[model samples]
Target chain A: MHILVVEDEPKVAQAIKNGLLSEGYRVTTVHTGEEGFFQAASQKVDLILLDLMLPGKSGIEILNALRELGKDTPVLILTAKDTIEDRVLGLDSGADDYLVKPFAFPELLARIRALTRRGRSDQVLKLKLADLELDCITRKVKRNGYDIPLTSKEYELLEYLMRHQGHAVSREMLAHDVWQVKDRATPLDNVIDVHINRLRSKIDTNFDQPLLHTIRGIGFIMKTEDEP
Target chain B: MKLVLSFRTQLMLLNTLLVILIYAVAAFFIYAFMKNRIESVELEKLQEQVSTVSTVVYKSGGDYNDWYHLGDQKPFLIMEDWKVSYQTTAWKDLNFPDKLTPGDFNNKSLKTYSAEQHNYLVKINFVRTGIDTMHNFQVVVAMENTEALESVEKLARSLVLGIPLILILAVAGSFFLSNHAMGPVKLLRIKAQQISAQSLSLRLPVINARDDIGQLTIVFNDLLTRLEYTFEQLKRFTADASHEFRTPLTSIRSTGQVALKNAGNVNDFKDAVASMLEDTDRLANLIHDLLQLTRHDAGRLKIDFSKEDLVSHINSVIEELKILAEEKGITISFLHPDTIRLHINPAYFKQAIRNILHNAIKYTPGSGLIEIQLRQEESGIIRIDIKDNGPGIPPDLREKVFERFFRIDNARSASVGGSGLGLAIAKQGIEINNGNIKFVDSNRGATCRMVFPANSAQDDSSAI
Candidate 1:
């Protein structure tokens, strides 16, 4: 997928470009709002990652100008301001999604994947990684043809991790998506760690290979091979 | 010209003007009355002289020499048979212009005349010295009233002269009275000037609490007290925030420096980076919490209240944190009714209850028991108690723990991985929801008691 990034900060813009390039996506970057608008109007990018505070023309003004020309390309807004009104205004101005500043890289990747997969009807009910399998319908888990008993919270945690098996998921993503915690300051870090340890012990304690892994300093990841 | 007068000066000027107005009115009435009294008395004296002169002439048998002694002291004119028969020597110089006849006495027996700028009171009388009509004679008595009018002029001069003295006395009296009345206010001003921001604890002396100025001083002192308290809290908050910020930065710096000097392989370097990353995450959370608190203090956060099932909401919070407690072999028991609806901001209420529950799980040891009780009192207050069989907080530090960055065991808090702002944020959220949270004495462990008033805990399902 081709993504257009409009950001004035050089370091942030470069980091985004490198991250997205390594993830096997085409990236186009611009510094000023005027150049961003020009490139967006001329190019055929699949998605646009626009920053709210640009030098020449504001992100809101450009979004208005683009929408007025009837371009419906998906746009995700990145902003330093995280107030409720700013989020509402961004969405009202035809933004497809919004990410607050200082957001985690894994959280950003998750939002991008969700935004790009907006209209797809692909749903996976059963998830597998080598010997472990999860049945979303029955809310059951099994490994090596034996039933694995898990608590309700553990089931939810395992299903979320298995859905995005290969990618590392940050604690912030789990806190928001799985735990449904809205406040970023809630002291749920230790709780997430304990639950992860229990889930690891329960599934991998009696197995020859462990499917769940911790990427230390980052978050938890599920994979077939043992690697950091 | 606009003269900006002080309050005392204005009072003095008003008093002086009032006194002058009263004195002027009295002086005018008295001057008029004295003039009228003197003039009427002079006319009566002239009438008495006329009767005496007529009697003397009646006894003398119409002879001028016999009554001439009475005329010697004043002026007199005698007319017999309608002709001027006798005139006093003094009466001749008086310049009497008109001759007196019985016709002049027809309507009045007295006349007043002014000649040569001298005033006179004249009385005319007709006397019968014999039985025949020819023996009848008319006597005219005239007196100069210059001295009577002179007495009246003297009285007016004296009255007019007294005005300047009264004015001087009124100004001085009013000035002294205003100064005495404003003495307390002047003292208040001098004392108030001595108070400054550095010395906010100083109070304005109340000279008389029953008076207006004293009451104003008391009110100002009350305001200063509140300001001083808020100022002190701000100073402490700044110091604590700086310390919190430095704690994580210190760890990160030390870890980085050690890694650079001692790392022999990429794994060692990676381990150091990981540890530093953890510290940075902690710092980020601290900054986020501080921002949330500042927003709450500024009254910038919007609250949307709705009716929710309190039992289910709290049950869910406990459920969410049950795994953490279970991981430590701790057990939590929640005792509540099947349903208890309340008006509250769910997000804020959840944040508060979640933080309190998290603190309990963190402090409670392995195999410890945490009990949550929810019930409504008879006084229409909804109370929730979260008790844990852990080391309890001392009574002295119960209220202090709500302060920002306050910890019961400072050294042990670091290992607990708490940002030290949990209870502060919890207090703010609970206050916004019209609830109060405090620690109550329990026989075992710590008990956090939260209460909501009747109005806040009301069940109004139809209204949002």
Candidate 2:
């Protein structure tokens, strides 16, 4: 999937661009409203991360212009203005979603994932890796064709990881997306570790190969050993 | 030093003065009229008596005895051949002139004389008895005029007593009337005094809408309403400003705390520092914009105006902002006449234009088209219009968008990162240059128009 980031602040734009790139998505970053508008109108991207205030053009103007031109690219408004009127106006201006500034990066990624998932034609109800299988509709998991009981939080964390399978998932991402915690200041890494340890003991203890791999100092990755 | 009196006191004094003047004039005229009437009546009575006495003597054929027995007791003497031939007993007691002079014998010759310390009216006349005898008699008649004098004195006494009484009544009545008239004004003053900054909602009482005082109260109430509204708006503005500042500070604190708590690695510390730096930059920008607004409000934002080619100046600003526009893949096109010179504060003028252009670029989509046009019209106005293919501001918000801290999309504006002072500052800058800026009607995109008087450029230069 390809995403375009339209932000005027160099650091913010770079951070979002880097975050999306590390998630195995093609990302393009632009600093001005005009450039954002140009790339959005001319290029094909799965999603557009739009900033409201830009040097040349505003994010809302770009969203409106693109919509006026009949472009249906999903737009997520990222702005510092968090008033109710601002949110309503942004969504009413044809934005698919709105996120306030100082938002958790994991939350942004989750919203992006949700928006991109809706645009795809193929819908998968079941996820499988090695002997571990999760039936999304039934809320059930099976390991080596045997029922593997899992807690709700563990199941949710597993589901998010499987959605971005074979990619590195940061502890902050897991805490924000899986735990639904917005405050980044909360010390949730230990909790996330405890949950991950429990889930690992349940599925990988009796299996020959472990599917979950930790990328030291960065985050965690879920992939089979032979894939590398 | 001039004496300053309250309106009520002045009004009362004026009413008293007018009443006294009218009374004094009326008394003087009445006294003069009464004196004239009383004097004339007394003289006529004395003359009638003298004529009656002379007729009785002439009819008796020079016999004075019959005249004395006529029963008119008024003092009279008829002398013939230098003798007091006919005199009443009362006439002998009066010190009358024994030899009547010819001047005294003239008809209707009246004089004021005193008898027994009483005022009397006397008249002397000459009478001829019979044509055959050719006898001339000098008759003098005197009647008491004390009654007429007493009547005049009575009138004078009444006037002297009544004038002060009437003046006192008029003064008291005027004081009451003035107090009644100014009662509403006093009420208004009391109500106005009760209204403080905290109690601005209070309003003066309007007792009678048609009266002057009532109308003044109504006007004062209207002013209070406006003041209350302004005060409320100021309060809201202060709250919003503090909130704006607090949000970033909170974010910086949160980010730093989290980073420090999880600082097991150098990269974690680096990430925390970076986020803190971004927050600080945002804070600094906000403070800068606030300072500019404060200076503008204080009338300390100085603008040194001089004659300059506006076209070149605008061109340079466009050049400076083009790179920013190019970053978004936006195109900016400028069209103007060969040269348009106007008196303007170059820095401020450029800042205003830059703000507008920046807004257009910020709002327009990438690869959007921005068109700027400048022209000098026959009306001596230099008009500049900047049009962009962006979502135009809503019609309702066109005027409000210029207000301080006004953002159309608060949430969107936050993430986009702006101090919300760009347009407000732009407006101030333009006004300082004696120019006006407004949103023009456009079919597709937002168009902003600015106008400056070209003639003033020459006027300013000549004055310098």
Candidate 3:
């Protein structure tokens, strides 16, 4: 997998580069916003590590510029200013994820792996729970080969839950992963509830057995929805 | 002099002196002028009596002997030259006084004089044998003891007594004016005494014109204004810091809920749990610094001093910074034999030294040198020189580097993950323990120094 790190601080950038290189991923590092913009457009990078505060330009501006050019490559913002305003602005500017600095190198590695999971976007994978089967590609959903229609948000949420199958994900994780957004500005669990409700509606409404089960006091789970 | 006593007594003594001086000067000059006028009038009356005798002697065609007595109700004038001369008709004799009167000028030499009944003033005139002027005669003027001269004495008495009374009133007036002049200063004292951190908004009243007191108010009020402004800025900064801190803290906490709910691996859960712990630590540090600053504001920070070996303590501090140094491939060295031990609070003193060392290692270039020197000087002071080859602090802002919440450029980056309270805490700790810390000397980069007394009984074994 190819990743580009756009950070201004030498130590943090070098650390991330060396760390990612050790993980056997192709990593290129750039220190300027203009350089990040040019590299994102011309280079074949699967992911980008962008610092929010930069010398020449801000990471939000770069993120927005990349998005405006229809580059959907996941961009993770690395920042030290852990303020709601910065997080909101970063996500709203089309960043895939946000991570505050002074972070453990292990967390950075986890986020990089999570971000590069899209390299397998085209691989065929079917998620089956009870009678519900979702085609990973072709956007097909069926109940015993009977077709079902799902909205864009429902499909994305179902995809995220099925990717972490057999386990419950809280409202926050669901919000960040499925919504690709920060927590504060969006009414966090409320959006998660609406999308989960709609996904359950398309997948479980009028079906004989429900596959999306709500885990009380925690979040939701995509399982057989059976007691056993 | 005692403060309050001096303030009141100096004015009181000055006013008494002034009033007494004015009374003495005015009474003395008035009495002298009145007495001189009275004496001049009395002398003129004596001269008139002498002239009367000369006129009578000339009218008598140079009589050899005669008696002349001028009779009034009380005879005040008599002229004689071995005889008496007067125009004593039967009507004059019948109308004259039979008893002596005070201040009446009389002489008995004009006839069979009765000295027992006469109260007189006498004057003798001399005549030379060769001179052909009018015959010399003796004259006396005894004015009756009448109220006319007594009125002069009464006038002098009134002035002597009345002058002091008026002076007392004038002194009282001076005291009143002085008190009135101090009115604004009293208000200022009250205003100042009422000021606390809670009520820092109150300002000194500037109700008067620009005298020294008014100028004092201007300066004092300016101090108050600055204090209020700093308080307000501090309040806002704390709010901003808290608000900023809560976001990341919330993120970490919420992320924990997810990690716990999912059947995630121990490694993944540990990552999430570690982030939460880090956030809590940062939050705790922020609150701790804020509390420390509050204590400083209250002036309540105290230090307990004891034996501290600078050499051993510094080695441990350097060892503490070694973890950070190892990350960057930088090294710290002590260039001098550290033979210094002083009395200090070991915990806080060590904290100050560790902060300086940590900052040196934090800011220095990779493969750079941090040199520490400890030397004892003749002035009874132990000085520590901690120098680093790094990007030096800009000349303009060296002092500001120690202020709370003060950070230079790129201070908030991951490369320098300081809480921005290290130097502030170090300086505060240094001051609490009765030591002085500052940027002592810098060469191509920077050198900072902290010095304190070296004459204490704390042993120096760790230096070797």
- Supply fnat for every model shown: 0.56, 0.00, 0.00
Best by DockQ: 1
Which candidate number has the best TM-score?
Answer: 1
> What interface RMSD does every candidate have?
1.4, 17.4, 18.1
Provide C-alpha RMSD values for all models, in order.
5.2, 23.3, 23.8
Q: Flag regions of model 1 displaced more than 4 Å.
A: A226-228, B1-197, B458-464
Please report, in order, the local distance difference test score of every candidate based on alpha carbons.
Answer: 0.87, 0.80, 0.69
* DockQ values of all predictions: 0.59, 0.01, 0.01
lDDT of each residue in A160-194, candidate 1, tens digit only: 99988888898988998899987774568877988
What's the candidate order when arranged by decreasing lDDT? 1, 2, 3
Fill in the DockQ of model 3. 0.01
Q: By the DockQ metric, which is better: model 1 or model 2? A: 1
Model 2: how far residue B442 lies from native, Å: 1.7
Better of 1 and 3 by DockQ: 1
Q: CA lDDT of A213 in candidate 3?
A: 82
Error of 2 at B191 (Å): 2.7
